[model samples]
Structure formats: C-alpha cells, structure tokens
Target: MSFDKFVKNLSEDQKKELLMVLKESTDTDNKVAPKLVPKIEDGSFTTSIQKKQTEGETFGVPVTEMPRFNKFEDDGSDHKDKQNATPDVELTERRRPPFKKITQTCTRCDNTVETHPQFYREFYICDRCLKK
Candidate 1:
C-alpha cells in the first residue's frame, strides 16, 4: 500500500509513536554530525579582522554625536565683491550631423541606389525588384 494510505490506516497511538521515533532519529543525526567552521589564516585559526571590528566598542560612533552640515542655511555676503558675478558667455545645446547615405548595386536588378539592403534567397536586392 502507498505511504499516505498506510498513514491514514494507522491508529492515533501508532501515529504518536511514529512521530516520536522520527523526532528521536533527527535528534540523534544532529548529535552525530560535526559542526563545520571555515579556515582563515595559513599559520593559525585566529578570528578575522571584520569579526574583531564588529565585536569592539571603539569601531563606531553614535549617529547623534557625528559631525553634520546644515544645507539650507546660507551666510549673507555682498554679491558685487565676488569675482565673475555675471557670465559673459551663454551656453547652447549641440546638434548632431546628419547620416551620409551609401550607394550599392542590387544583385537581381543591377540597379545603383542609396537605400537599405533587401534580402533575397541568399543575396541582397533593391526595393523595386525585392517585392517580386
């Protein structure tokens, strides 16, 4: 019989005993397995610098005690005394040069034209004969 069918046929006491046995097996497996730790140094198994930094009290300062600047507050000063008070030159957006069209002969018609290549069986043809 299938496991689900067998489980369904079991009595309440039998189900309880089966669950207890499964729990005990898992507990024994955990106890028998060895816990693994990654090796760091070539000479000794010392704790990493990152671990030391995280554990030490001197590594970091509280955010409330850190230095900060007030961005909104501006000290008032005379504008005329400052150098380059007004800009002499104006800035403008640059325009790109137009694309240069290339001419090629169509394989089917032997016509010279400046247009995108149209695909034939294994060769390129001009637009006029490509439809045929």
Candidate 2:
C-alpha cells in the first residue's frame, strides 16, 4: 500500500502516537551524538592557559645569541669580475614555438581538416563546420 493510503488508514490517536515517537527518537539521537564544536556564549570562546617561554634554545643546541633580522653585510671580495664584465650580443626579437595541428575528419561534415588538438578534443568538429 502507498504511504498516503497507510497514513489515511491510521486513526487520529494513532497518528498522534506516531508523531510523539518520531519526536522522541530524534531528540534521543541528538543527545547521544558527540558535539563537534564547543558552543560560544556572550560572543567569545574560553581562552586557553599560556605556557612559560624558555630562552637560548636553537634546534636543541644552546646558543649564546639569537640571529638578527634583515641585516646583511657585503665585504666586496666575491663577484668582483662579474660586476665589470659586459655581454657581447643580445637578441631584440621575441621568439615563440610553432603551434601543432592534427588531421581529423569532421563529425558534422565528412571533410578532413587540420585543427589544434584542444579544439578537436572539445568539439570533434572542424572550424569551418563549427562556424556554419
């Protein structure tokens, strides 16, 4: 029997009892499952206690001083020849690789045509047939 017909066969008291049982089952399921996240109250969560900081430890080795940030000194002993060297020639024109075309028969028109691999894979139709 259909769900509508089965529900229609139930009396008024039986329908009320079924609804009560469904509501209790859902409430018990929600209470039994563990909460994934903690609930926040008054717009803030509980803060954790901070641990004490220890000094003079670098990769488990005791160092006398910490490294300074953004400080670099140049002694000018390295790259002395490269600074005075000059290039002989330089190209002024931009170069690009040639496009690769594949021959495939058009799905729409049976004529064989050359097209890029990407266009053939996407539409499987030639440019002339696609424009038409």
Each model's total of backbone clashes:
0, 0
Candidate 2, 1-132: lDDT as tens digits: 998999999999999999999999999998898767756676766777766655633463444465634447888877669667676887678587778999888778877878776766644776788798
The residue pairs found clashing in candidate 2 are none
The residue-level lDDT of candidate 2 at 120 comes to 63
lDDT against the true structure, each candidate: 0.72, 0.76
Decoy 2 TM-score against native = 0.25
Q: Which candidate achieves the best lDDT against the true structure?
A: 2
Residue-level lDDT of model 1, residues 1-132, one tens digit each, is 899999999999999999999999999998898877676666985765764543324436785676655556556565766583886787886797666666777788888777533322345577789688
- For candidate 2, the 10 contiguous residues with the lowest summed lDDT are 55-64
Summed over model 2, clashes come to 0
Ten-residue region with minimum lDDT total, candidate 1: 115-124
RMSD of each: 26.6, 26.3
lDDT, candidate 2, equals 0.76
